[model samples]
Target: MRIYQFLHNAFLFAASRMQAAGLEGRKEEQRLWIQVNAYRDFIMATGQVYLFEDYLAGVAPTSRPHVSTALGARPDTTSQRVMALLLKAFDETPEPEQKQSVSLLIHQVNFIADTGQLEACEDYIHNRLDYAPLAIAHFTTREEAEAWLMGPAEPPSPADILIGDEYYTAVYSREDNVRFMSRDYVIEPYIEELAAEGIPPTAPAFETRAEAEECLKSHPASPFDFVSIAGEHYLAVHHKRLNRHTLHPVASTLTQWEEQKRVVEREEARYAAMNTEGEDEES
Candidate 1:
């Protein structure tokens, strides 16, 4: 009996050690994730500084007293002062990855300063460090930031509309049988039309056709042309009048596309629930 008791105690001790090791591993993973996320945020914020500097330089050459003039006049004697607080924050609790990235930025900044190219300084700050102080300084609100970053939002697309590779194609008329060639097709002309309809050139709907096509192609289905929403499976259809359906998965209307997505999601959920019920019955 004593021998059996000893064996049981040993097994329990081993199990406890395994559990502790697993917990420690999990804690380490969480720490790593937090460190990575912090590093990414820091890099993104720092990168913006360069973009702001570029804008300033571009305007500085043409404008009488460039925007950077205001930045230069501020009590902050050096641009480094503007970023000092942020840098300090990063230095205090930097991830290993961030340490490497920051070191690269320091090297790039030193190289650009040595070259005496003012423009290179902006590139060093924006591209190398991911800092964007100018953007932060200019846009005080989230709405303003979004407008500057992504352009102004516009009216939502209409329902039952199919966007052609070049213009708005009325696809709602053929609702059931309408087939898309690809999700990547965009209608450049439609963007111009929207602009004519009083929407700003910088409206979100006014996307470059080539960029839209590239984005849609990355997805599985053809996007609705009107709102540029993708369909389930991309099908490239040729339009002789619009020249050709050069790419597959043409952009589509967002409204109708969202409806289709809802339907698909509901069907999937229904099937999943039915499978679960069957499993329970078997059990």
Candidate 2:
């Protein structure tokens, strides 16, 4: 189920990116765009988008290599991740000023809940009047907020759980600490650099561009070497007579690396199952 969801999300992300790139009108892309969004809407209606994204983040790599052509962009920090959920919920990218408002609102909601003030409300925050921001941030009406808060006693969304020290810091500082350390990061080939590394692509391909860049920066290397393919980063290890790099997503980051691993594992399991079935048929 997890793997299925992950692949579904990849499709979701790809469709959205394609739509954003203005390819939505094409026949195949059009069908995909509509279906992806319809499915996304279903997921959102269930309020499980946050959980899905969180799970995806956990299984995906955290690093972004300087060069790697791949699809998708993972939010690097908890706040960006949380903000992404909110953006989807709102169905619009908040303007810069509006983003600040949303950021502040998230911090405020987290604060109200953490200080035990949320418990003191005794009903809906609408009743408290002082906590109107919480209601406004969540539900459209104070009554709605009141009912949900007073009834299930659960936060309106699972994303609320991701609000923590790291998230709050990003909100307050207006900066995510998770960033590339190498400002001058570049991937120039070895002295005998060819237009392309003739080696068959064997290294694990990082699925997302953001994860590849992170891996490029954080994945430690002796004398720190890598090769670039259409701007994607991959670690280069000297092999045979080739100075070419076999670019793969770094294992340490594990975003696409994990996905690739999962794919291979699933294939192996399927192969084993097929073999077992053959043996049974022989019997």
Supply candidate 2's per-residue lDDT for 250. Answer: 36
Error in Å for residue 159 of model 1: 24
Please write out the lDDT profile of model 2 over residues 1-283, one tens digit for every residue.
Answer: 3433544544545455447546544564444333334333333322344444443344333221111111113235222333344344234534543443333333322332333333332233223222111111223344443444345323323111111100000000102222111111112223123224443354335566455545654553332344444445555432111222123323322354355458879999999999999999999
For model 2 the local lDDT of residue 214 reads 59
**Top of the candidates by lDDT:** 2
What does the lDDT come to for candidate 2?
0.35
Q: Which residue runs of candidate 2 sit more than 4 Å off their true CA positions? A: 1-25, 60-153, 156-283
| Worst window of 10 by summed lDDT in candidate 1 | 166-175
User: What is the C-alpha lDDT profile of model 1 across 68-156, one tens digit per residue?
Assistant: 23333335323334234224423653455444333333322322333343343344334432221111122234444334333332211
